[model samples]
Target: MRILVAPDKFAGTLSAVEAADAIAEGWSRTDPEADVVTVPMADGGPGFIEVLHASLGGELLAVTVRGPLGDPVPAAVLKVGETAYIESAQACGLVFLPTEADGRTPRPGVAAQASTYGVGELIAAAIDAGARRVVIGLGGSGTNDAGAGMLAALGASSEPVKAMTSGPEGLAHVASVDVEPARERLAGVELVAASDVDNPLLGLRGATNVFGEQKGFVGDDAKLAADAALTTFAEAAGRKVADAKGAGAAGGLGYGILLVGGRREPGFATVAAAVGLPDLVATSDVVVTGEGKLDWQSMNGKVPVGVAGLAGSALRPCIAMAGAVQVGNRELRANGIEAAYSLVDIVGTEESFAHPARSLAAVAERVAKTWSRR
Candidate 1:
């Protein structure tokens, strides 16, 4: 039996590379002689740079950039040839958001105050390193400032620089925006916004309403204010991409990318091409893909679904192994997955969280018992 294992990061636990290794280990335990090929995947999220670096063997340029709360954070850019791959989560990820003084997780107020200034810094660093094309992975952000902080960092002028880059509270006070300097800074450079999300920059299905609750914009009042603040910022900038497919990605970081003439591409597609996923799927006997959770969002250009689609197109059986499987069997079938296995279902929630790699391996072993023809 030949099996191909490809998975995204399991959220806070296993990275895509680790998850693929665990799955390969367990499958081999079930069928020691089976041929196993492992490929880590990402959809422009936390593991974007790591996965690309692993597959492409790029020059990893390390740098320190401002975090969401103005603190310094370690980050890296992957420069392959003339193209640079940057993961935005390193600078403003939800995991980096600071907790309250009471030791509780950040609330809407704190999320509202987060910034994306570091992303601009990373882009600048990539440019300085002689990258003619920069591909920015936009997801897992902690800020809700509509990329105002990033714009400010990239040389966009506003009435009060501090307020313009200080998150929503300061955004509410902003008046005008000049993006000429920022545009000039990127002259002769190509920018690509790599993301899975397609939400607009504002309104019901937009960033603030669709993804705000997870980042702390919970109440109606808070969402309204956030939307209004971003609206004011957008009007000031005079850029017309609020309704663009990925304009709401990474808390409006997509909008900022568009404002600077960046084109949007599906993050999964970008990674898939880099990793030669299509060729691998066509030649593999069985395909296995996974992530932290298999939910409605998994259908939205995420790694697992994208892999499954390729497997299906190649007439190969595709299976999914996830930390938790929330989608129904019908949905799984609709998405081209032959079956879905969950670590939580096999080992329970406690063990799954405590030993993610082990639990995932165990699940893969059991799955192999059913699928391994060897």
Candidate 2:
């Protein structure tokens, strides 16, 4: 039987490629004759750069750029043809910070002080290299700033950019925007924002309310920051930003991209098309996908769900194997997931983290064994 192994990164533990390898290894032990094909997937988040590089042949261009707090950091951009894939997390990712530094405990307050200047630098670099299109994967960011740092790197005035950080009532501070410098630098380039979430700029389900706490914003501060950023963006662009789809993504970076004439698309669809996922699924008899956690969010434009949908449309069964499966099996089944399996349920969490390879192999072996009887 032909099996397609396509899985998203297992968050802190394994990358999508590694997860696929582990599943393949375990399945091989059960059925040596199984024809397995592996395809690594990402949700346009932290692993976006690596996944794009692996799936689409690209050159890694390294450069020195400003980190979240204005510190110099080493970052890289992936270039393919006249297009470049840029992941914002490279410069301002939460992982860039240590749990403890200079004898002090780290806190989420650092996000407010972070910047996306480096991402802008990467975009500029791609433009200088003759790139005609720039695909920015927006997720796993570490800043709440309304892309002020990025605009700054592109020579936009900080006065108007800083207005985004002012209190909600001060949104009028952003009276005008000068895109002259940015337009000069990125003259004919098309910018595409590949975002994983569809949350708007402000509201209960918006950027700060839904994702700020994970990046460090909490209580009233989250709402305040989001509102201020959205208001400033709307005022500067002379349009409503609060209701814009994907506005809350990557701490309002989506709005910034939109302002720069960028188009927003589902993260999975972008990555999948880049990797030729539809063609792969069409030829496979069974498709297997997984993630670190499979929750309700997985149903909302995540890579695994996207893969399953593609596979189902081709009349193929899709199985999911995850570190933890939060949603009910019935819900998953209704969404084109034929079966759902978890490493946590079989191998225990401690053992899984300690030896993710072995734990994942065991999970795949169990899946193969169960399917062999069918």
Find the candidate with the highest TM-score and give its number: 1
- lDDT assessment of candidate 2: 0.79
Off by over 4 Å in 2: 97-108, 160-176, 240-242, 372-374
Compared with the true structure, model 1 gives a TM-score of 0.96
lDDT of 2 by residue, 245-267 (tens): 88778877787677667788999
Q: What are the lDDT scores of the predictions, listed in order? A: 0.90, 0.79
* Tens-digit per-residue lDDT, 1-374, candidate 1: 78999999998789999999999999999999999999999999899998998888979999999999899999999999999999999988888876666544566578888889999999999999999999999898988887888877888889876766787777888877888899999999999999989889999998899988888887999999988988988888864888999999999999988988998999999899988999999999999999999999897678888999999999999999999999999999999998999889889999999999999999999999999995
